[model samples]
Target chain A: MDGYKGFLGLLVSSLLVGFLSVIFTLIWVLHYREGLGWDGTALEFNWHPVLMVTGFVFIQGIAIIVYRLPWTWKCSKLLMKSIHAGLHTVAAILVIIALVSVFDFHNALSIPNMYSLHSWVGLTVVILYILQLLLGIFIFLLPWAPLSLRAFVMPMHVYSGLLIFGTVIAAVLMGVTEKLFFALSGYSKFPPEGVFTNTLGLLIVVYGALIFWIVTRPQWQRPKEPNSVLLQPNGGAQEGAGGLTVNFSNVDTPDSKLNHEASAKKRNFTADEVGQRSTM
Target chain B: MDGYKGFLGLLVSSLLVGFLSVIFTLIWVLHYREGLGWDGTALEFNWHPVLMVTGFVFIQGIAIIVYRLPWTWKCSKLLMKSIHAGLHTVAAILVIIALVSVFDFHNALSIPNMYSLHSWVGLTVVILYILQLLLGIFIFLLPWAPLSLRAFVMPMHVYSGLLIFGTVIAAVLMGVTEKLFFALSGYSKFPPEGVFTNTLGLLIVVYGALIFWIVTRPQWQRPKEPNSVLLQPNGGAQEGAGGLTVNFSNVDTPDSKLNHEASAKKRNFTADEVGQRSTM
Candidate 1:
């Protein structure tokens, strides 16, 4: 488990660095285009956004693994595990498709054909996010779950769904913007400008900040220990039990042997004798 | 407490509605301008972006209030109370300023320059938001606070920060894009194009989605109750004669009083006698 966790952590961090590199590359490309007095059409085909989004997906996967570690428990633990498993499964399948398309594993699959794969993967991520959102709603409604857990889980569900939503928006935006910008420049066959692409980048950053807030807020109430005996009736004596038994009727006297003998005799005595003894 | 909570809720909801309504109005105005064939000079003012941003600020304020209400603890409660007091004071001042500016109350005092009060109140609202953010940060760091509280607070911080950030970005973008587009169109000033306006609208929506995601994601570990007794030692006891006594000793039998008395006597008795007494 530790080894797997470490691997996932490393994978996420590496992907993050890669994503940052892609962003820097995009900035550099933009600056380079401006310096060269070239229009948007003269720029090379850019895969930076794609790579950055892929990195984000990997990071999401890492989040799932981290939340599923053994020490997590109760509602949180359960919710995390469920989300982790569900999301990872879907993410993995999407990643595989993305990998195949990127590598052109099929000789018949042209660049144009890959676009469909990308779109499909993007849509799948969005759908998975929606499912997770429903799961969040369901978790909150569970009768036995703690209220505090529900409160905490609701925000997480919202945040993750938003991340996936943002990613899809960004992907669509990029596709549209690139096509529109190319078309408007009259140097390419794509559309002049896309409403979706123009807005995608700004949305991602905004959503990222929102998600960060949801994950960091403090909670007031939390689940107590599961054992009811700890809060037992009879002044909490059940909590301090250590496998010992005492009979009060047999040990009423300070003199232990005499008290025991007396108790033994009393147990055997007739009702009349017991009544007389009690009167005495 | 319930009344205060309800009032805060109503205030937040109203603010949110007002904020969104302003945006809707701006969108309506933009569409109206386009329909009226308003030319270059009219669009240069770009009042819509400013109004939309102002609306967003109110939305952020309400979101902060909503997030803070649930897990509010000692210092946070006091801080929130003070914030409320400050808001009331600010509201009163704003009202007085509005009355002076609108009804010419300042003329009675032979002062013609009280209109600056409007800007001052606007600035106060911004300042209040900053203070609320700082208080949120402090609340997030409190011990014994719920993990969800931290999760919720941090995202709110980020969302609020981003709304501020996005507003600045939008303002800058509006300025730059207007100038660039004007240069491209071979006019010193031209009415904002459908493309530019639409692009800006898209940016706002994208950012809105991002904020939604940030507030909803499940990355933060929910706060757990302390497992050790030392951390919450007094949790088990109810009120007692001397406040409360946590009985940690192991005399839990039904005849605990008798056993305790006998044990005290045994301490004075010889060791051999004590042993014999126990066996008996």
Candidate 2:
């Protein structure tokens, strides 16, 4: 077996590297280019990359992988869910600010908005991110949805979460490269700052690959507790109850224990859920 | 159960879209920019993106998901292994050509190589891709290695395969965006070409998401035949008979039946494989 300490050590180091890489990108932008602000100027556009990468890339990554950290297991699943949702909420707010900065700066300069591929893809991902977050809260946290609907949405939510994380990284990479190429068009990239910015971009890619590795590897997935509520409380209430959770065994994230208990008790499902579970 | 027809239909459609996206990218470059060539000019650099996207992104994606196609289930393992390895080999060749074109064009024009983030990440991916391909063939296809060694490396091989696929897409996205921004400098993105290229990129992202969803989802993984040769031929010969295919459950791709029979008979290992399977 792999050493527990080794896994934890890697996790800590990667987390530090991931966070620091985001910070380093921001620092490079502030140090070499323009300092971050929302003063409705070209300098305001600098906050666009820094804040977006910080929130959409680094902070969101932490939120997604929070369950995998050992210290999180000590908390109740409800607390962890709150923490997950809370972190994502902060990320969402930061991204909104980032978007506003970009749009405002563009508008102030009479520049066209939503024109570049980076802008197009970046805007689409931000929309998807907001939708994913909203749907996550609606289905997972709020009591507006029933239990079986939550089960059906959970896998898609997880997939979208990871997909969005990846797309955000792509946007970051694309956006940064766009800025560099546009700004440094006269030169052939022999400048030291060009190399420095390229290094920053590489760090972003490394951070992204690291996050994907930590989150997606099967062995590194959060292990199921064997007696999670789905198996126990729903056994008598629903037919073929375990089918809905076959994918859960793979993801095995400890979400919300309160929701799990409340949702597990209502195991009855309509034809739609049956169809969903069949495809599960 | 999910309809076999429905799953097959989605797979076929997505594959077509994925393939066409690669073609669309190629056509866009050929039509709008310089047509494909290797005369050590700026036009030669055009071939880099088209060839890389078609081969590394599209064809490599096909290779990764080939086993998931139900028609491959009847093949006796070894044929599929050959097909998988052969496809990857072709992809490696294409990527090499793409890289050479870039480097060659850069050299002729007195431009620097590996200066951009896309080139840095792209070159690293190519190196890793070649290494992954070699290691895979060595542990999996070549007769030099024992089955226990293959089993030990299976999980990492699978993870690396998926990781490389994701990275290739990231590199493609980065490379494409860099080209667009650099080329479109001094002009705002208010043109038909920009729209067309953006659509091309969005297609790549969609195609990638579909491939990942198909290959990584649990229910959609290629199912292993329960009575594959690893269990039968090595029953009496090896101490731990199933040591050869412990992680075969994960990568249930059909490979060479001959190797399965021949190598399955000898499961010799010096204790490392013993510890490996415990985690497996």
Candidate 3:
């Protein structure tokens, strides 16, 4: 458990900063800007920041690290994966609403949409996110994929998930810069509102950095599934006939000794648990 | 070399897009804005983007992956480490120059400094980059640290390196947004300048993403040093007396099976080559 030494501390810090970021965003929009509203006004645009921080950045951060929560290791991986996907699903819906708010606000003010760098990167993050969500469900949630295929896609899925998260933070930082300049006339002079929002932006970045730090630590990863159903090399064709195909790519590195041991002891694992076999 | 497949293609793509981003930044500054210069002019501000993209983003990207270059695998690791550190040093110098240019321009126009979100984040990246460089040299480059200490710092070093890179991209994206809005008269209307700059911003994101993707792939990492000098566990206190203490953090993950193999065979490996031993 040497690896897990700082895990809890980092996890707590991540949660602290993550929620604090959301709270700050809410404070920025509600206190500094007009309070949130649904009407096609500038207030509607405020929803974009609030929703994005809550659902897109903060919730997405939680989803990325949820599997690493040692307390949750007792739960079935299928349940964990479901929760992961569910969080993502919620985030996607919030993002969509946020986007709708932006477009509505733009139309209300006759401001052109998709014209700034923030919009360009923000839109890309959105598209990539939804694609990642759908792909995660299809390959990981469904039991139809072959074990090998699932294994192969797992690395890319994990990498893209983290990358997308990083991009989300980047896009939000850009969005913040845009909003500050557009909303605050004395931004250059660092008025109270400007300083508060600037601090908020810094908090967002710190939140992201903390999440990235916590998730990438090798020692903090979930232990390998105790009872995975590994497929036989000769039984390739029957992989997806009705059995589980868990993605091992995320749970263990390609060079893990535990991975080799699992492969050697493949026959011992139950077919039903194959979908849960990950790092040890 | 199943892992090495597509590595070259990806490396080439990273380099191509990385340079293309710099070129586009240059075009945006020189072709769209005034040409670069010194002597406290707005044109001097152009160096801020140009130098940052070239050195901070592009060269830093190259530095991060230099160890992963298979062709360099044949070279002595000490040489490779030096080259890696050397590239980072070059990048640090360029970033410093970029900062100077921005400050000079701001001072000339009597503009206050470090007020904007971009400046806050950019300065943080700068400070962190310098700290990382210095720490890497102290713990990695110098032949003084104990193996255990080196191992402990390696994960953090790698994680911070990537996080800083991501932050750099985020900071740059914000810089792009700020510059476009300030410089372009009709950014909202999608003028030619606005379109080109926005594309430039997107290209920068693509470059950073490619670098992230390439560096994170397990297959693409450099092979372990053929003859590393390992240390005895009991001989830890004498580690930095005169021999090397190469960092394995960046080269191999903690979960690597080969690491266990190496540990079991620790007595057989020459201590001189321990600094070089990485992944197979």
Candidate 1 Cα RMSD (Å): 25.1
Give a tens-digit lDDT track for model 2, residues B117-219: 7887888889999999999887676655544455556656765777688778878888878787767553475777777777888888888888766654434
DockQ of each: 0.01, 0.23, 0.28
- lDDT of model 2, residue A137: 72
Output the better candidate (1/2) by lDDT: 2
lDDT of 3 by residue, B1-280 (tens): 3235577888888899898899998988888999989979978999999999999999999998897787786876677778989999999999999999999999999999999999999999999999999998887777665445554466567768888989999999999999887778888888988889889888888888888776664334454444332432222211111000112233322233556655765654323212223333
Query: Per-residue alpha-carbon lDDT of model 1 for A130-169, expressed as tens digits?
Result: 5764564355323343332333343345345434634443
**Per-residue error at A232 for model 2, in Å?**
14
Candidate 3 runs further than 4 Å off: A1-5, A229-280, B3-5, B229-280
Best by lDDT: 3
Error of 1 at A27 (Å): 21
**What TM-scores do the predictions have?**
0.25, 0.83, 0.85
Model 2: which docking level applies?
Answer: acceptable
Residues A143-178, candidate 3, lDDT per residue (tens digit)?
665455555466568768887999999999999999
**Candidate 1: segments with Cα more than 4 A from true spot:** A1-45, A56-280, B1-45, B58-280
TM-score of chain A of each: 0.29, 0.80, 0.83
TM-score of 1: 0.25
Model 3 chain B poorest 10 in a row by lDDT: B237-246
Model 3 chain A worst lDDT window (10 residues): A237-246
